[model samples]
Target: MTGSFLPYGRHVVDDDDISAVAEVLRGDWLTTGPTVEKFEASLAERVGARFAVACSSGTAGLHMATAVAGLSPGDRAVVPPMTFLATANAVRYQGGDVVFSDVDPQTGLLNIDGVQDIVDRARNGIRAVLPVHLAGQTVDMPSLARLAKKAGFVVIEDACHALGTEYLDGNEVVSVGSCRHSTMAVFSFHPVKTIAMGEGGAVTTNDPDVYRKLLEFRNHGMTREANQFQNRDMALDSDAEPNPWYYEMPSIGFNYRASDIHCALAHSQLKKLNSFIARRRELAARYDEQLQYLSPILLPPLRIEGCNPAWHLYAVRIDFKASGMTRKQVMVRLREAGIGSQVHYIPVHLQPYYRRLYGESSLPGATAYYAATLSLPLFPSMSDGDVGRVVDTLAHCLGMN
Candidate 1:
């Protein structure tokens, strides 16, 4: 673990996970089947959600959630500038506009003050607000929920970075996907995420209508239930009875359904979610303690009031301006020493496509934050020695030694 190249993030799959996938493959069903439902049920229960809809990727999950939130053409959703493009792209996927909101430069949190300013300025056209839990740090959902309520827009939590994350409601802890604040909490099961399902994601909601729409949208908008059908008059259905094979497609939808093979691994991983997060927190604490003294690198924010993070990525802002060296130079030095690092984002509004569409808009806080942020290697599988090695090498790169 000391000598091997450390990645910014990685999945931990034990024998149990392998056996689960193998058992599922050996079964009669491989795609949508019992395993998928079991995974969904397990996810829903774990996240405190009333329903969980499995989907192809986090992007697809966000798309479905946005659609459920009424993010259609000519509407707009306010999103922070500092996040993966998928957060805004999902809004565009529904043909809705994305209005950029700035973030807190130090913590990378979507500034609630900035959000309120955007909402107060815009009299109308904003249909939803997406607050991303960047780097596993849960946003202040309670306050954001209040803002959405006042603004008359739906709230959808882009919780891809936050799975085991939770927040205290005075004393009672609320899970991230409980939808206790937002309309729906979306999650990702990518290999690099807190959970690994090869390629999968899910949407968790308490609203039955949103849950129903999520299910229908993921399955090509086709429903087999006769009661939900629009055009009931058909040879397959009659007044007294219905055909077993009859199905209906009322609206356009995508094939965003995740396969059972993926869900098998996800369910297996879900069993160890708490432990995985525990180890990740341990590693992150180790990094924070060791790297705090280094001048060139600002350690990640270890705590937020009322929130408990899942420790997805240990993103530290390198003081490149103070160090008189480029972030690229520090990253190269770390890579040469077998340590991996990454930039969490480059401000979605500045992306090539977004730039073209928005015609060169700027959010100063997100821009300044992006200039210094770098994610150091932090994963559940990393040992204490590995953590020390990373800190030592990073210090050396910054001339702290």
Candidate 2:
């Protein structure tokens, strides 16, 4: 590789971002302090949610959501195959069975029809449906929510890639994290995501009970609030004054709390989310314009009306048979040319563990999408020239002018 390597995604950190973290480091409490609450409040307000709980990672956030949704053994949750492992694993963490649903073969998005089929077949024990907003393109949440309401299942959105995405609710523009349709929505702040916090995540919800439950679940099921305490004697002194060190573990929970350092960095990064999304959109348009003429290498799937994607991944579908090159070979060639690419996911059901657990099941949509999808470099900091270079190199590797 002669030129600088271009990764599929990267974080953009400014001096101010460093300064925010530095300020936190200098503060009194580093783990659970005012900065943590401030960060949570900022995220909740940004997404128009009543509450937000910050956690250590996206997986942790998903686990917490599943816990709050009351998933247990014998309870089944619908999970689409075309998502990161964490999306499905979260359900398993709560001792729940996963019913793998298919996605749109073109868009790699969860198909509402596929979910409907699952619900129709299993009328009972369906506790939740997790719809992942893959590649920052939103799922048809309105339709999914209606289905959940009718089927008596909760809807939790895996919106890790869709921090800045928006869609329409009637004539109103609704943000992805607003939880207007779903019961809860989760986001990630990994370096490769829309924002970077080293490792951080948040879940947003409008339901006060769910919000309180999420908070309790994020911190070892411990509650500091005396009102929620089950044991009054231990939580209070003779004068009935709350004991400062007293806390109650009402339910088993994990230590998924996000630190002030991570939250501070994420809070700073959140301020630039709009601009970051705008730049990513600009880069996506450039890819579309330039790659249109290359045959057998299709652009990203067409979005439906009212879907304004955040463009986390500019994944194009290449018909490997027609292109006369395997996906692996193309990736090797691109790497030699200093351009990076990656596959968004393999079907979660096809995983060996899942196959062993659920047995072999056909999901043609997810299978087809996985076979053709290849995510090219896409991030806010890449320049127009970088886009041109990547396209030129990809075209050359594909033997197209």
Candidate 3:
């Protein structure tokens, strides 16, 4: 195992997953069928949400959620610069402006004060506040929701890294996709995520109207349900029964539906979420214990109270400058040792497209956090010995003991 290359993240698929997909492959329905509905229901129940809408990708879920939230031209949404570009781009996709907010230097999560400042200064046209649960850690959603309520904006969570993540809400523990604190929450099922669906995502919400809109937005703004159709004459048959072939497109939307094949695999993976999370927690703890003494070169993720992260990525901060090498140099050396590493993100505000669109803005925390962070190998299939080997190799590569 030591001689084999270890990736920063990978999916763990068993025979059961293959069997589930194979069953779907052998069935009649492959896209937009009963399997998709079953998967949606299971996800909704698991997350304590009233409705769950499955989509093709997390980015698609974000776009649909924003569309349903009424984001429009000239509208602004507060986005932290420390997350993936999709989080911010989703707003732009709706022709809305992205108001970049600074994140906590230590945790790469949005703080209430920073977000509040952005909202206050923007005054009018602030349509939504998107708080990303970076690295599987939940944000202070209760506080963010309160701020959104006060400012008359919606709160949609970009929870791509936090499918199984949980946090305390008052006296009760709630799952990340519950949508109890935010208006809607989104999740990703990429191969590297907590579960694998090849490429899938979902949005969870309790509002009935939003739920209906999400379904419409996922399928080209079209609906087969006669009750929702605007053209009643065309939708109903001669006997007043709904026309079986009738479908209406009321608004512009995208083809973002996840196929039945993907749903079957996702449903199977959902059954083993608890086990996957447990294994990840064990690996994270091992890393925490073993990497404690590598001072001046590394700092493990902060142990936040009241939050149980799903451990999507064991991202650690490394002082490459103090370690006498550039980040690229450190990564190259680690790769030479048959170990893979990655940077979780390079602050979105610093990206070329954003700079050309919004101009440069000062966000020191995001910049500092981006310069030091690194994601090491962490997945459910990795052994305890793998964690030890990663730490040992990292230390050796950095010229530390």
Candidate 4:
């Protein structure tokens, strides 16, 4: 085992990025200014979406999107079980119920049939279907869209893991954020994501109404348009107008806006997104080639026929019974050998809060994944030597030789 520690994921920051944030800080406006708009425009252009709305974090973006979708009390949203709790928590933020769906055992993404089952069985004000692209793999959006259309469910993609992924359609590959099949797609720019911005996120949509709602929702339901307000000139007509200090709080909303500094960093990071994704794919390929002979560990599932993954995570399943070691034992041994190993998630439904709120019955597929899965180090910044060290450390921990 190597003496150096290998982490599962890390941000690749450069001097240029630091300079960009520094420049933003030196400017006049620090919050919700010109840089924020520029960052939104850049994100929209890159993702092929007509409009992008920046926010404080991925969870904030999700909440804003769900709000724009008109989810209210008594509404229900369908979500996959094999994802971070935020995916489901965003629904609860709007006082809506979350109906959990099972994931594909191999890819850890939502199963189309499982979604269909949930939509078919939904009753009492089911409003939207939130399909999470787990581990940066593209979900079957086309089929899911069709299902949503037939079932009268609004489709909101929790695309935090799939910023640069593309969906397969025979010979054609469509990007996930094009909103090609869903109403709105959300992305994160956290330190561990494909694009790191310290803390930020955005919502992408082609629908003008949804875009307008998101814009208003993110900024505390206040509109800057003079024409929309009853009193156009608040300062000038203070004595004549009913409420001269005038800004209509048309609807209840939250302050979930991103700062110009974070946006600046995200814009800089966006420039290297393609390169980062390429490197991630390269690393995944190396793992596949080297681990092919290791029967005790199952590598991540292959990309769908025409889909391209961003490769945010490289999770492997261990056959603990066959390997004569438990998953816990393997993880402990790997950490002791100076390799950083972690689990992506413990299915949303299995969490203490979810179990208390939704009842703690085991989801066979999600539980199976949680039991055997371990995320290995796979980031763009890793060197070939680092990759080798990770693989060798795992082999030693698993007692492969």
In candidate 2, which residue ranges exceed 4 Å CA deviation? Answer: none
Which ten residues in a row are the worst by lDDT in model 4? Answer: 235-244
Q: List the residue pairs that clash in candidate 3.
A: none
Per-residue alpha-carbon lDDT of candidate 4 for residues 1-401, written as tens digits (9 for 90 to 100): 55677788889999999999999999997999999999999899988899999999999999999899988888999888888878899999999988888887767778889877766676563599888887788878889888878888899999998889987766677887889889999998889899998888999999998998898899899876555565445623646544544566678788999999999999999999999999999998888777776764656555665678898888888878778888889888888888888897888887888888889765687877777788998889898777777777777777785
Q: How close is candidate 4 to the true structure, as a TM-score?
A: 0.94
Q: For model 4, how big is the CA root-mean-square deviation?
A: 2.3
Q: Which ranges of candidate 3 are over 4 A from the true structure? A: none
lDDT of 1 by residue, 1-401 (tens): 24999988899999999999999999998999999999999999999999999999999999888877767888989999888889999899999999998988877788888888888888665799899998888878888988888888899999999999988887889999999988899999999999899999999999998888889899988777767876666624445467777788877789999998999999999999999999988988888888878843565664788888998888887779888778999999899898999998988888889889888886888887888889988878899999889888887888887
Please, what is the TM-score per model? 0.97, 0.98, 0.98, 0.94
Candidate with better TM-score, 1 vs 4: 1
lDDT (0-100) at residue 187 of candidate 4? 94
Off by over 4 Å in 4: 230-245
Q: For residue 295, what is the lDDT in candidate 2? A: 53
In order, the Cα lDDT scores of the candidates are: 0.88, 0.92, 0.92, 0.85
The local lDDT score (0 to 100) that residue 47 gets in candidate 1 is 91
Clashing pairs in 1: none
Can you write out model 2's per-residue Cα lDDT over 34-64, one digit (the tens) per residue?
8889989999988888889999999999999
Model 4: residue 15 alpha-carbon error in angstroms: 1.0
Models, CA RMSD each: 1.5, 1.0, 1.1, 2.3
